[model samples]
Target: MGKATGFLEYEREVPGELDPLKRINAWKEFAIPLEEEKLTIQGARCMDCGTPFCHVGRLISGMASGCPIHNLIPEWNDLVYRGSWKEALKRLHKTNNFPEFTGRVCPAPCEGACTVGKSGSPVTIKNIEKAIVDRGFQEGWITPTMPTAHTGKKVAIVGSGPAGLACADQLNKAGHDVTVYERADRIGGLLIYGIPNMKLDKGTVQRRVDLLAAEGITFITKQEIGKDITTEALRSQFDAVVLCGGATKPRDLNIEGRELNGIHQAMEFLTRSTQSLLDSELEDGKYLSVKDKDVIVIGGGDTGTDCVATAIRLECKSVIQLEIMPQLPLSRQPGNPWPEWPKVMKTDYGQQEATKLYGTDPRRYLTASKCFIGDANGNVEAIRTVEVEWSKNPQGGLIPVEIPGSEKVIPANMVLLALGFTGPEGGMLEQLGIERDERSNVKSELDHYTTNVPGVFAAGDMRRGQSLVVWAIHEGRKAAREVDCYLMGSTEL
Candidate 1:
């Protein structure tokens, strides 16, 4: 440890963010970086616990307890505290392929399992990580590196999300040729489109993409395996094929007037907005406009929060987020103990912006939309909602029961369904002849990512269902190791 008593002497601190109301006026990252000295103080807060659980990366009670990619947190913290930033960056990149992405958007399960957090505040691990990588970029420490030797084995990956990129990077480092195919016009599937620029700037995603391209990984955008090229053709050409296409099928509300105009999936709205912003700085007018419109966003998750922020940026007249689940406690409950992800309340950037603009939190908990009410022109005009209470059903499972006489109507000009995804889209899986599990995810063992078909593998959301980007990176790395072994009967990944 850099300083044995540092944890006792220092308190946790993070970088400041732009004022929510002011930041909403433009689509750019709002987090202000902490100075090197302040970040060093934050790094000194890492405890000298002999058994550090921050990198355990295990699931406890169906939630991530630590870093899924098993980041070396304590080592980097020590290095940062000692002012050895270059060394700290090396330790960070040893495990995480994209610290910039995770540092910006990861929920930081590592901090939840942080040993220091058991007693007081957790170390500012996330901010320190971002600082190290961002510094590495500024100092030109990160650049293209050619492999020492080529194994002459070519691999094809059918996605350009975190999982696919991680897999390509690992394979390329192992002296194998790697090609990544993306269905979208841009390289990053989720990072570039599904997430708005306010949360994670598109330039950050593109910078990493360009670096990977310079390192010999081929990127083919606007090419889908099942559509533009057949799965069989891809398999025949490549020595191995790994599927990292994410679970992108948005869950739909099957209520009356769902087919009405002015209602859209959250991804559709986000993707179009990001594409337009990048193409013309939003001058293209290709995205759905919500200006001066009362927007109702259903579903209470990260995606829902993103919708709220995006609507605010577009200058919506009013916005509200409806979550059927009851509000989480301000502190951890009895069921959620130390080292597990705290099921406590958190005010994300989007919610903060809404609060600043509207003078109140825009979230309405324990409320569920009953149906969409439309005007004669077939446009959604309002939403019928009812309050719900969760109770144990006959099967001893929790279920939301609607309360009588709790129905109400809320005016809405646009409705965005931010409900989570069910599973990966079926078209590509069907084309590849891959078997699906009961939950419709690709059938593959956890550590061994190989599917039933020879030379074919699956990883990330396509195999594990919807999950965090860090987990996707872990899956991609594991799958790459397995693919390397399958091809050469051994691996050093």
Candidate 2:
């Protein structure tokens, strides 16, 4: 809630992004920074509605409607509108430890639930949040603060992803001796590897990692709990354990020519690209660069979008994204009510780049891959695909059927399977003997993060399956609270 009459006086606006053609030449964030004065006006656009559904953070009709972390959106918006930069930063850090990441990538369901969005475009909540945090860091307001006194309890966190990082930050704040275990060579799990650096600067990830290192949280990189360090040793050494390994098993395309040389999983491609960027020598003959190659990304979700952007930056000859679902409408449908998140089609940075370059959207909706056409050298040369339609069967579940004579082969020397992820890898879970849900995710009580094993808790994607970074943060905080309670026998979280 910023200004009572501000909604009527001003319209919503966001920062301009870099030119698509120019931005595609390099791996850098495309979104232009909003000026401070403009941010104040954007904050003023907050409607101050009687019911602030923006931060509800609940499930309604099987879809997320608000900020899952229950961020103090209205309070921060009002503070920003009043030009209270420090106050806004303070309110932002209360619920979100890392606003910079969420600001960049979060879908901002809060905006959808905003009262202003009902009538017009909503306030630039995500941009304002990013601006506040960035200003805080620039002004040296964000520094690591070690706990006043250590509780003498040790907590072992498995995974350095968002949830694990949040859990470590909160647990450290609560005076627990926390040790984070990561299998990767560095901290900031997917934030470092899975996400391309152009969208999120690795330097930003390193900055947070350094801050946490200074805050007395011990990070043991290249040390896997189940493999490098035995789970038994961790449980014996630490009073409590929090599992945040994340859902990392990439969903594979099991169709024909699945083992083709040129075809790679989205995570693999992203990982190689990030590693190459991190270490120039790592790019030595093995890395997958789309330079001078025709790139085809399968799946139209965020992962596929990321592939498109990455491929463009790699100077690929062409990039095409195929989605099995039909294209979305431009605006909200009648069925999508005010409180529910709207399913609408819009241009993201990658598609915008593809449009600017190729003169059309990179996505082809309602498309399905039949097989990979490989060259004599065993490398993929093209993709055989056809259009698909979904219909309800006699039972109730919808089934996808391929249309006759719709088959076509598209040129592609490189293909990235951006289909998505399965549950978390089974190494740690099996080593600890934790029970998995039917979907292979760590099964825990709805609100509780505790696994069947005593003194062990799982959260984030590992427990809930693939999800957004904001949800991972929420899961981490909640799991930390539960771990704190399990250790102290009180609701102190």
Candidate 3:
């Protein structure tokens, strides 16, 4: 709304990324932010649409369409266009607790649902968002807003991931004494360990964690609720307990030669690599090395992309990604139209890096791994794959059917299973006796987020299964409101 003809005047522009070949040499964030003047032009591209779909957080065809946290996209864009970054940062922080994290790592569904994207490119909302928050941090506008009064009610959050962090932030704002427990050696469960440093810098994660600590929120690391401390003890100590332990039980590939040595779960590999890099810069030999080896990553998703990027950094001789499903169309198909999450092929940063180095995209669509072929030492040496065709099963569902005479073997010294997670690990749930849904996720009502137990609540990946960081923040905020109501009789979160 800053300029009526802004969309007509300005073409969509986004932040530039470092050269693929140059960026692959180190573990650092590669995206170079746009200057203020260019970002103003990008912000002007936010049209004055009567119904801005970019801010309407909803599910279209079972996929997210807009900002999951329902960020005030248009308002911030207008502010950014008019050179009111302080006001823009205020609006950005109103909903999302961690804009920096989401701005960097989130797959922007907001752009997919952008009103401007119907004909031409969408507004660079993601880059603009990053700019606002980054400026807030640089100009020293962001600070710890400690609560004026404590409610005398203590709440325990069992996770240091996005969900738990958001919940604790909101609850602390509501004057409740919030304490977070993380099982990992450091805070920021997946943020610090699971994500590669190249994507979301660990320093950024620590900065936010430190800010939360300064806000009077207590964070206890290396302490698990069900293991080191009993659930009964936690319940006795705190008035309410919110479980945000992410869905960590990774899905496995149960095939021939499943017990091979070089096959590792994506989280295990990513976690170790990050930990080693932080500890000794990979010189301690703590993480599994894939240097000078042919790497094969199974399952085509974000994690798979991360694995490919990690392998490239490790100086792997070659890399390939195996995906069971066929590749999506380059653009939206006939059945898929506007306002829905586009089902199209997206070459992520890692794939782009691999393509730059190997002269081909690492992903292999419509392929299924049959079995692992190992050497005499029992380490994975090669993998047998079969081209698959999608056919209608009797149950009226499409399933992968292996094509006859399409079997082939590919050299692979290391195989990383980037398959998605199943659900939360059962140890904590079992100890807490929380109910689980059909998907093995902690059973909690969508809006209420209340578990079967009266004082216990669940949110984020634990309740909703594996999801984006933006959704995790939304869940955390919603759950915090519900927990506040339960504790104080009436809530004002």
Candidate 4:
């Protein structure tokens, strides 16, 4: 789709990032954009493989292999290479509702599945995508477009995260009155609070929200279902209801000293930090402070990385991340071949900053927290940890087996649990009499998204459990189509 021999001619190049030491001083996005000419050359690296797996958007061995929203990667790459920036933007928007969000934070499984990457470096698809969309906004090519006509049907979407926003956008485009309800004081759900400002600035999220509002989707903040509003009232008011409320029940460590005063869930730490930052530049002291305190972050994922970065920004004395799993290989193992999301060592932004400052990696692999030790004042003072080896249980499933004489105590005044979420909170689900799957997710079929209730639907993290923002958008768009079909007997969405 790009130059026939562009893959051979051009080496992959991505945008530069600010030095970790300097960037850690402030909470802002630090990725510097590549020039248009360089981005064009990078886009030319998109090979014309007969079968491009970059946009396959399927699971391979339980991991995402490509773009979850099925972005038209090659077409946009070709457009970028041809210097047709406007056309590239249009192609990008055809599949993705918010490229800015995914372009910034998505792990980019699309790059992992790139055809050229099988042999050499892959095309800079993520960077080119961000460039196209950023240019679209800069050139004033993107704007709010009101629906041509109104269907006079109203849809109430619970939750204003990516899923609910995408669903509301699609339903509104179908001429249905769409109103998004968020429990938080602001919209954008996870985008607003769950993610730290350093990764994705709140301004970017709010800009998109503003555009959606201009397009006629109503947004109501600080309105929670089952508490502020009842199920019966919502169903009676709207022609259909879609539950895009995310899976927010965080998994907990049921060990000794779990009730320590200084221990907190990852979301609570991140959410309060962002809120206070926005409210008064953090001078209000409404958020948790780890200044000059040793911090221990549990679980090894994006959330943990974010906690580490936030702690560093807050001037913590020291930070250490605990991971129960073994360290991944430096490159793809034979078992995890091409197109499968590579399980490899990644030094994310947080770890990079930590390495530069501490002269060592902050992660401690194959380590498990035994218990949190507290001071006489009831605040967490330290943590007891143990290294373990993976062993197969009777059922042939792998489990962490504690290694004897490996226990160690580390000083820690604060602990953040980044163990991820279990499932959706049960309040609204229970109130609506919705059935739940074994994993406690909303019981709804893929591509169908209908619950046992006549017009009640579900999508995103609520139905699929915690997932990438791209997947949530895909679910929302699909669910919107189903709701449109249910309402009018068929849909063109």
Candidate 5:
């Protein structure tokens, strides 16, 4: 709304990324921040659509259409256009507890739903968002807002991931005494360990964690709920328990040679690499070193891409990503119209780096790994894969059918399974005797986070299946409101 015809005048511009070759030499984030003027122009591209779908969070065809946290996109874009960054930051924080996290990691569904994107490029919403939050910190506008009064109610969050942090932040805002329990040595669960340092700087996660601590939230690390402290004791001590443990049970490849020495879960490889980098800049050699080794990454989602990128950084000899699913089209299909999630293909950072280094994309679509072939020492040496074709079954469902005579072997000294997660670990849930859904996710009613066990609630991946960090934050905030109401018989959240 800043300029009537801004969309026509300016083209979408995102932050410049370091060259693929130059970036792979180091693990630091290579996305260069945009200048203030360019960001203003990018903000000016926001159209004057009466019904801006960018901020209207909705599920279209079972896929997200806009910002999951429902950020005030138009308002902030206008603020940025008018040179009011502090005001934009204020609006950004009104709905999102952590804009910096989403801005960096989110795929920006809002841009896909942008009105202008129907024909041309969408506004650089994600870059503008990051600019606003980063400037807020630079200008020293962000600080602790400790509550003036206490409600004497205590909340024990079972994880320190995005969901847990958002829940803890909201509960603290409502004057409730909140304590976050993390099983890891560091506070941030996935933000610190699961996501590599290059994507999300560890210092950024720690800064927000420290700010929450200053706002009167107590964080205890290395405290497992069912192990370090009994579930009954936790329930008895805290007024309410919010389970944000996340869906961390990685889907396993149960084929032969799965127990090989060089086969590992994506999280194990990523977590160890980040921890080692932070601990001794990789001098300790505690992580799985893939240098000069042939790496095979199975799965094509973000996790798989991260594995590819990490392997590239480790200077692996060769890397390949296998996805059982067919390759997505370069452009949106006819059925997927505007405002629906675009079904177009995207090349992530890892794929780009692989392409630059290998002279080709490392992704091999419609291919599934059948089994891992190991050496005499029980270490993975190669992977046997077969091409797959999708055929409609009797029930009109598409199923993968292996193509005969398509089996091939590829060198693979290291195999990383990035097949995503099934659900939350059942240890704490089993100890608490909480009910689970058909998919093994913690069962909670729609719009309400209360589990079968009273005084215990679940949210984030624990309630919903594995989802984006933005959805996790939304779940956390919504759960915090429900918990607040349950505690005080009302809520001002």
Candidate 6:
């Protein structure tokens, strides 16, 4: 701790955002970076707890409570407080390979599990994390730690998302020749396409990708295995293969009129929008624009929130989000307890923008969509929905029961299905003869990422279904160790 009384002296301070009305009118990042001196004061607030539960990275009450990658939070906090940014970055990278991505998107469970949070607010760990890595990149202090010699072992990573990239990074550092394959036109999969540019700039992603290329990691784009290139070729060419293919199959809304033109999957909408912005100046591309359209996004998750923000940026005529669950309480639940992920109702940046623009929160709580109503041209024009009530049934289980008089129709020219993902696409897994779990995800044990076939491994969404970026990095690191141990008769990876 910088000062023994620092926590008492400093109240918690989150980064300020751009004026709500002004930011809602644009497609740029809304949160302004904190000044370095202010950030240093925030960093000084860390008590450096004796136990330091912030880095525990464990499962509690069926949810993750701490940093999943087990980041050295206290060490880095101390480093930042001492104005040792270079040291802070080194500590930051000890576990995480992509802090820039996680810093922006992760919910920061570490803050929830913080020992300092037991009585008062937690340290500004996430802010300091982003600041450290961002400054490192800006100062040109981050560079490739290229291997001194190659072990002549070739490895093929079958995805370009966070999991695949992290696995490739660890393997490359271990002297294994690494190659990443992406079906998308770009290198960073979800980072470039699945996520919005305002949250994670594509240029920031490309900057890292460029360095990885300079360090000899070959990126093969527009090359899809089991389709463009056969799985047989992958097995025969690479000494070892790590499948990091993410869960791309979007969960559907199996209701009436689902085949209408204006209705589309959440990934389709998100990907197209990001690509369009990244290459908007170009003439030849397809992207769904929500201009002057009535948008209805079905689902209450992060994807749905993203749809709301993206649509707002496009200046939609109006927007609404539907959720099957009732609005949660603003404060934490007694059942949830401390150190467990607080299941409280906190508005994200996107929803805050929606509320500011619409004069009320756009999310319709305990609401469910029943069917799509389309216009004469077979284009979606509206959606039919119902309000629901969730209560414990006789069997001691909670279920959503619809209310009698809550049925209504909402105008919607575009309806995005942001429900969620079921599992990874099985086409390539079928070709590799990889069995799947009950959920249709690649079959693999939690700590053991090996497949039924020797020298074959799986990680990330493919192995563990859809999850957060921190989990992806964890799974990738473990999968790299498993692959490295297979390549050499050692356990050092």
lDDT by residue for model 6 over 58-122, one digit each (tens)? 88977788998999998888888889999899989889998998888888999999877878898
Task: Give the alpha-carbon lDDT of every model.
Answer: 0.93, 0.90, 0.93, 0.94, 0.94, 0.87
- Kindly list the per-residue Cα lDDT of model 2 for residues 279-389, writing each as its tens digit: 774456456878999999998888888889888877899999999999989999998888788889978888999999989999998899999998899999999999999
- Tell me how many clashing residue pairs each candidate has: 0, 0, 0, 0, 0, 0
Clashing pairs for model 3 are none
Task: lDDT for model 2, please.
Answer: 0.90
Taking all chains together, each candidate's TM-score versus the true structure is: 0.99, 0.98, 0.99, 0.99, 0.99, 0.97
Which run of 10 residues does model 4 get worst, by summed lDDT? 444-453
lDDT of 2 at 71: 94
Alpha-carbon runs more than 4 Å astray in model 5: none
Angstrom error of the Cα, residue 246, model 4: value is: 0.5
Kindly report which residue pairs in candidate 5 clash with one another: none
What would the per-residue lDDT of candidate 1 be over residues 373-426, giving only the tens digit for each residue? 999999999999999999999999999999999999999999999999999997
Candidate 3, residues 1-493, lDDT tens digits: the string is 5567888898888788999999999999999989999999888888989899998888889899999899999999999999999999999999899999999999899999999898889999998898999999999999988898889999999999999999999999999999999999889988888789999999999999999999999999899878899999999999999999999999999999989999999999999999999999999989889999999999899999999999999999999999998889999887889899889988999999999999999999999999999889998899999999999999999999999999999999999999999999987789888999999999987699999988999989999989988899999999999999999999988
Which digits, one per residue and each the tens of the lDDT, describe model 5 over residues 1-493?
A: 6566899999888889999999999988899999999999988999888889999878899889999889999999999999999999999999999999999999899999999998999999999998999899899999999897799999999999999999999999999999999999899889998898889999999999999999999999999999999999999999999999999999999997898999999999999999999999999999999999999999999999999999999999999999999989999889999899998899999999999999999999999889999999898999999999999999999999999999999999999999999999978999999999999999998998999999999999999999989999999999999999999999988
Stretches of candidate 6 above 4 Å error? 282-285
Error of 3 at 224 (Å): 1.7
Model 5 / residue 334 / CA error / Å: 0.6
Model 3 worst lDDT run, 10 consecutive residues = 1-10
Clashes in candidate 1: how many?
0
Query: What pairs collide in candidate 1?
Result: none
What tens-digit string does per-residue lDDT give for candidate 4 at 1-493? 9888999999998889999999999999999999889998988888888799999899999889999889999999999999999999999999999999999999999999999999899899998998899899999998999999999999999999999999999999999999999989999999999999999999999999999999999999888999999989999999999999999999999899999899999999999999999999999999999999999999899999999999999999999999999999998899999989988899999999999989899999999999999999999999999999999999999999999999999999999999999999988889899999999999987579999888999999999999999999999999999999999999999
